[model samples]
Target: MPLPPTVADLTSFDLLLSVARLGSVGRAAAAHGISQPAASSRLRQLERRLALTLLDRSPRGSTLTETGALIADWARAAVEAADALGAGISALRASRHSRLTVAASQTVAEYLLPAWLVALHAGNPGLSVTLRALNSADVADRVLSGEADVGFVEGPAVPSGLDSAVVGADRLTVIVAPGHPWSRRRRGITAAELAATPLVSREAGSGTRGALEAALGSAPAAVLELSSTTAIKHAVAAGNAPGVVSSLAIVAELAAGTLVAVPAADVPLQRRLHAVWPTGAQPAGPARDLLSIARRR
Candidate 1:
């Protein structure tokens, strides 16, 4: 859009402000890459439109008249506002071009993604990000199929056809209510015993579920199957049954003794948490910035 007639564009006002600083109309015009005659004509037209004599023109150099000084002050404010508007629009453009989509597993989404996202925003304030929470298998699929710009998952292995970095580690922990028998045991539970016990568990295909299955070398006995980590945590805390879940998901519960972590001494339940992207298409822009932050941790 064009500026209205009363204000002859921000540049004219900018030149007005500059002449007051530069002390010479010729030098102000030179600084702005315009001829002195053009600058003089622009100021003349501005004064004519406002019906105000602004500059005290003389042979020595141009100086602001009493009214001219007040107008210059007002023009300075307009120029400052226009400069702010330009910066805001530039940020909007940056965000439009740097949009990012991220897919993460339930545990990582619930426990870890927020901090990384906050850091990403702090480092690149104009970056635009969208987040999706899915199971590890689904997160990998989305990244590999180009449905997402980046992905985070916790699993024994990264899915085929995707490149990944091991950003962190998580362990599958068997947790039970404080009143449960497992909580009272001095000895750690064996993998076979854990598999034999009926437990509350996530539905199949989640990285948390996969990690438990791999540790036991078979499917676990589940008395109830839930779709959400929060539900499973609630069910376990109610003493209905023990549940195998990520250590990351149970920090508060364990700290409060609402749920106790059972030592699965012989189970190799540790899994690598990864940041994955499409096989040959490396992450760039905001995705690259986010991945770089995760890699640092």
Candidate 2:
């Protein structure tokens, strides 16, 4: 039987995913064995065929629009399935041949780790890195179970049974849509008031949530809870409610005037970021090198 039009266009979807992962079209072109101009033309043709604007390009990189991100997730699953069918055992071997596995909290993964990975790649040309992004609790769990070589966390305290080093500090920011009532307030919100207000928040078990909970001494009133940072950003920017999130998460939005920060007083708005490994076992090789870099940063 003949395949559907979408099936015939699988390469375009793969190109989309590659650009999304690598952060630029030029890099995606090289990954997919095409020239930069050719990849750009193909992407434009794909959008014309589908009648959709999928990417929002910026000076630094291209980001998927909301509709684009949704479609890309679906496309990624299909691509993985096709990859498994095409490569079979070799794909499994390639996955298992990874040299380093690092688990990190949402804050680090979204904000910091990409730059670090790029630096590591430049210095160690042949090194392969595997990154897992989860909450601090899960990062510690991965380290403890030997599922990860090292883990980066941002929380009030290091988890029990893990040895950790302070790498940096992450400041939490309280943000609302520009037209929200909080944006116009002259004084900082009291901890009680901040806790009482309904907010768009991270799901439970996230390091960002953990830090918020610790500062509030209890749970904040959540009007909506989402697991993805993009989803939360959208909810807040659409005027759902105020949100307390890692400062690094909203730089682009803030610069674009899509969100505004509210002064937060009487709230512990900072948390220490740490690199953790199993108890009695210090990181060696790639893990140790990464840890040193993180500390220096």
Give all TM-scores, in the order shown. 0.67, 0.66
Q: Taking the tens digit of each residue's C-alpha lDDT, what string does model 1 give over 199-268?
A: 9999887888888888788887888999889989999998669998888888888998889999988999
> What's model 2's overall lDDT?
0.86
Which ten contiguous residues of candidate 2 have the minimum total lDDT?
90-99
RMSD (Cα, Å) for all candidates, in order, is: 10.4, 23.6
Best by lDDT: 1
lDDT (C-alpha, whole model) for all candidates: 0.87, 0.86
Residue 236 alpha-carbon offset, candidate 2, angstroms: 0.5
Among these predictions, the greatest TM-score belongs to: 1
Candidate 2 similarity to native, TM-score: 0.66
Task: Flag regions of model 2 displaced more than 4 Å.
Answer: 1-98
In candidate 2, list every pair of residues with a backbone clash: none
